[model samples]
Target: MIRCTGVRHRRLTIPSLAANARQIAVIGPNGAGKTTFLGLCAGMEEPNKGEVTLFGRKPSEVRIGWVGEFPDRTMLFSRVYDEIASSLRFRHVSCRESDTRVHETAALLGIEGLLPKATDELSGGEKALVAFAAALVHDPEVLILDEVDSHLDEEAGRRVADAIKSRPGVSVIACTQNMDTAAEADLLLYIEEGCIRHAGTAEEVFEHLKETCFYPAVWRVRGC
Candidate 1:
């Protein structure tokens, strides 16, 4: 659903990225350009060097839901319900449908009780869930999540993972340090420095990890 050719921004350079999988995981070390790469795919940032296209259109023109590493960046409204409902409201969805979608999305992320809470009062993990809910409510064709589950606990993380996995038509490209989450993805891309060092199945990427001496968190998650 997405393609990048010689995509470069700042220090990162992805020679090529042809992501056709419905669920793709971007696993990499700190400062490995994972977020930069995601921004290119989301059309949030334009590459100074190459091209990135999503679903045959520019990333900005495509319908996509994105959640960044920081939840606060995604927050605009003060209330949780309004935050999740914002997307639907922007599209002029009926109030009844918007309300239903808001509540349903909150419930899916196990944050039903939080619907009445204030956005500023939520914990970091809670805010993350809210941010994710906001992205999911509109049912965008592609979901770009940049290390969104980092602050979430194991259960919350699984909830997020399960929710994304259940979406039949939405393609997801998540950048995560959580190897267990990466392991569940349909495809894996291992990035280092500013390049995609390897792009393949989980096993194939892990094989490449075996050759490296660092043995990062992803390797630990794989019991390597």
Candidate 2:
């Protein structure tokens, strides 16, 4: 869970985004502060004004897993299993436990067969999933994914969705451009011009955006 109030950093301003929603999907055009918002949520960056809290504590004080838009930025190991286990190694987890967690997380993300592959040789989507597995390996309290599905195909996206849906205890906040993916979230946030234009159920937000310039015509015609 996360909460923010008048959070401002550079050109972005989040009036508020209440916590407690199980899964939140943030959607907006490019440079709409989606990534900035997630960074603030995960404590990757500081806001010039206002406040941000996760699970009743500041973002920096909480345990959170972040998978950025670029997988290569997070992948340091050559092997898939090693990449996922790197975090556990940094935390000084036992070798046996790290191995178990790495394999389990890979299987959950439908990438178990890739355990022995070379991380640098993976496809774009494969790299993303591996990065996600790394983030999830430590079982952080919250998971924040920033446009992680951008390069993923439909099947890959489904696998990501399944992994998120299966993790009930981990609060998820995902930012994406895909309307269909946003539609599947328990809560939807429509941000425009660095502000939260709407925050509610997916249908409610979609309905509010239907006739506006923000909603994609293709998705609107298909009835999101």
Candidate with maximal lDDT: 1
> For candidate 1, what is the TM-score?
0.91
lDDT of prediction 1: 0.86
Instruction: Report the C-alpha lDDT of model 1 over 29-59, residue by residue, as the tens digit.
Output: 8998888888888988899988999887999
**What lDDT is reached at residue 3 by model 1?**
86
Report residue 2 deviation for candidate 1 (angstroms): 1.9
What lDDT tens digits, residue by residue, belong to model 2 across residues 1-224? 67888888976887777857878899988888888989998999999999999888998887788999998877888998898998899999999999889988988888999999999889999999898889888988889999998978989888877887788788899998877777778898888888888888876888787766656566767665
Question: Which runs of model 1 end up more than 4 angstroms from their true locations?
Answer: 211-224
